[model samples]
Each structure stands twice: as C-alpha cells, then as structure tokens.
Target: MKNWIIIFIVSALVGFGAGYFIFQDKEEADGTNQTTTQEKESKQENVVKEESKDSNAPKTATTSDGGIFSEKGCISCHSVSALNIQGGATGPDLSKAYDNVEGKHGKPIKEFLKVPTSAVMSGVIEGNPLTDEEIEKIVEALKKAAEK
Candidate 1:
C-alpha cells in the first residue's frame, strides 16, 4: 500500500511539473502576441508622425472600424489585435495576407480592396460577406502591417 501511495504521489508531481511548463509556455506565447501588437501600434505612430511632418502627405484615416467589423461578426473568421476575435473562425491568418496582396500581387489598395471574402481565401469557418467599409478598415489594418 505504501509503495502504491508513493508511486501515485510521484506521478502527481510529474503531471504537475508538465502542466506548469505547458502553462508557462502558453503565457510566453501570449506575451509575444502582445508584443507583436504593440510593435505594430508603435510603427503606426511613427508613420502618422512622419505623415504629419510632411504637410503634403495624404491624410490616413485613424478612425477604427474594427468594432463595426466585430459587431458584424467578422471576428468569427478573422482577428484584429484591438478588435473582436473572441469567436474567431478558422480563416487564413490575416497577418500575412497584406503582403500577398501588395508585395506579391503588386495590387493597389483600391484594387486589393475588391477581394470577395467568399472566393479569394478559402477555409473560412463560414460564409459571411463584410461591408465595403468594414473591408476597407480591415484592409487599412493590413496595409499598416504590410508597411511594417
């Protein structure tokens, strides 16, 4: 009985250590996500500052339409750092989409803006088309990321 008790305790300790390590790694991953978002925000601030310094530079809209996108349930398939992604769906990571658009395709923002969410990228959790404005805001966020 004593030997069994000892074995059980040892097993429990090993399980606990494994859980601790896994959780610690998860916390680190979350931290990295936060850091990435912060870096993006910082880069955006720099761009705004530069644009402001150049009076002739075209004005970039800072108004966040992220909420509207979230409210419309875009988060069901996409994630925006400062927006709703609680029920985020199984879509291709939007993180790299911008580069595929501008860098690879060499498409203008307006042309890139014409993506039909249903057809351009597959593996979406479900079919739900976003409004033109919502697409613009999401595209804007993507463009900002591309610039970085």
Candidate 2:
C-alpha cells in the first residue's frame, strides 16, 4: 500500500511537470495574436513608402483592380494581413495563404478563385465573379503577400 501511494504521487507530479514543459513557451496560446510592436513599426514604414510611391518609383506588386477584392466582398469573410487587409473572422487569415494555394485547396490559385472549394466561398463567388484579369492581379497580390 505504501509503495502504491508513493508511486501514484510521483506519477501525478511527473504528469504535471510534463504538461508545464509542453506549454511553457507557447506564445500562440498566450493570446499574443494582436499586432506586435515590430509589426506596428513596419506598418508605419510601409505607410511612408506608400505615400512616397510616385510614377517613377519602382512599382510594388499590386492588384490591377486596386479595390476589387473588397469591392467584390472578399473582405466580408477573408483577410490578408500582409496586404494590410482585415476581414471578418469567418475564414482563415490569409497572411501566408499563397504558401498552400494548391495543397490546401487542391487547385491552383486562379482556379480556386474562379471555383472556390468551400461552399461558403462558392456562394460568395457565384454572387460576385472575378474576371480573368482580376484573378491574375489577385494572384500577384497573394504571391507578394507570401514574400513577407
């Protein structure tokens, strides 16, 4: 009986220690999803750069239809933070969306945009179809977003 009691206590302590070790440095679980100080500063710099973009300046990757994504209501559910976009939390954050364009959706970006895999997106796309040019521009924007 004494040995069993000692063994149970040791097991409990080990389990507790192991749980703590696994989650000790997990910042994602700490709820640090808000914009960090570095990200804020980076945004400020980007704002300055945007302001200084003249016709002669080297062009940054941008969607040809500047507001097409929002105009067509993508921002209603999706967002691409790297594009300085924010949207409702109905869908995944598209910060690194281009990384898994094919693997996640089982199709290329252009095709996915034209024919969304998700039912929700399918409805959205049905209501607001994107032109070939618009899809091309959006793909460029996604590629640019992935670079960051």
Candidate 3:
C-alpha cells in the first residue's frame, strides 16, 4: 500500500511539470506572433501616412503661361501643382502631362491639342479645337510645369 501511494504522487508531479512546460512554450509562441502582427500593422500605417502627405502637399509656383490653359477651360478638369490650380478630378493631372504627351505620343503637344484622342477628352473639346497660338501657349505652360 505504501509503495503504491508513493508511485501515484510521483506520477502526478511528472504530469504537472510536463503540462507547465508545454503551456509555457505555447504562451511564448503566441506572444511572438502577436508582436510580429503589430509591427506589420505599424509599418503599413506609416506608408499610408507618407502617401497621404505627398498628395496633400501645398502647391508651389504657378505655371508661366497658365492664362491659355485657363482660357481654354483646361482648368476645369485638370490640376497643375506648378500652376497652383486645383481643378476637378475628371482629367489626369496635367502637372506631369508633358512627360506622357511628348514621350508616349511621340508628337508635339500642339497636335494633341488640335485633336484629343481619348474619348473623354474628345467630348470635352469636341467643337473647341485650340488655335495655333493657343496651343503654343498651352504647350509652353505644360513644359514649364514639367520641368519643376
């Protein structure tokens, strides 16, 4: 009877020690996972904030020959930071239009002004093709904006 009692106590101690170690390991792994998740979330939030700051930055100097753009109602659908103008969001930002127009189109911006290719732009300028002088002035303004 005495020997049996001693053996039962020893088994119970072994079981308790094994359970303690297993549970401790699981708790440590859970803490590590939680920390990793928090770090990732923090990095994502920082990236979003940086992007937001860039988009919302204040406009700088106005475009040199912005009058032609304004006269042609280009200001109605385009935003040019160099021109310090914030138009509607309907059209792509003209601040970087020179790069796309001159590089991708492989033609002078004046030609595009005479006959815009995009459907949305075609509708906007359907009956209002810019004159030679107007196109020149607008091109000059866009080039200036792009340089900055």
Candidate 4:
C-alpha cells in the first residue's frame, strides 16, 4: 500500500508538471499572436486616418490662375509665400521662380516650363511632364505671385 501511494503521488506530480509547461507554452503563443494582431490593427487605423484626412484637404494651390500644383505633388517639394502656402522645404521657394527663369536663365518662362532643362527641375519634371495648358496656367500663376 505504501509503495502504491508513492507511485500515485509521483504520477500525479509528473502529470501536473507536464500540464503546467504545456499550458504555459500555449499561453505564450497566444500572447504573441495577440500582440501581432494589435500592431496590425493599429497600422491599418493610421492608414485609414491619413487617407481620410487627405481626401478632405484641398487638392490645388492657392494661386491666382487656379493652378493645381498640389495635384502634381509639387507641394511636396516647393512653397509659395505669396500665396500664403506652406509646404515641404526640399526645393526652393517658388515665389520668385518666374523672375529667375526669365532674368537669370535668360529664357522664356514658357520654354523653361516645357523642357525644364535646369539640373534641379529636370529630374522633378522628367517622370511627370506637365501638359501645355498646365504649364501655361502654372507659369501665369507664378508670374502673378512674383509681382506680389
């Protein structure tokens, strides 16, 4: 009877130990999965919020000619102080670009707008060439801003 009791106690301890380790491993796995799921949810929410905010924002710059500079993503690089517009400062302030293109570059603004041969502009316009109408409107807008 004594030997039987000892064997039963040993079996119970082994079972309990195995169950504890197995439960702990399962719990850890579930915790990792929950953390991963929460991270993914947070990222998705941020994306949705950004999209919503962008959709409600203005699509064009506040230029005289109603040029859609932001539509072409120019606002990501340049800013026009005359228009009271603030944008990324990666490129130059374009409030005086019209004057520079004509006076310094010694080329018609329209010609520069069409080809954009300058080092800084060529790369920006290469992949996304503007339409003649867009160039004309934007040039007019820039000219108006330069006058201010």
Best by lDDT: 4
Query: Which residue pairs show collisions in model 3?
Result: none
Overall lDDT per candidate, in order of appearance: 0.53, 0.67, 0.67, 0.69
Candidate 2: list runs displaced more than 4 Å: 1-66
Runs of candidate 3 with Cα error greater than 4 angstroms are 1-65, 102-106
Clashes of 3: 0
Report model 2's TM-score to 2 decimal places. 0.53
> TM-scores of all models?
0.35, 0.53, 0.53, 0.55
Clashes of each: 1, 0, 0, 0
Error of 2 at 143 (Å): 0.8
Clashing pairs for predicted structure model 1, backbone only: 76-89
Instruction: Look at candidate 4 and tell me the lDDT of residue 2.
Output: 100
Best by TM-score: 4
| Cα RMSD for predicted model 1 | 12.1
Please report how far candidate 3 places residue 72 from its true position, in Å.
1.1
| Model 1 residue 7 CA deviation in Å | 50
> Which pairs clash in the backbone of model 2?
none
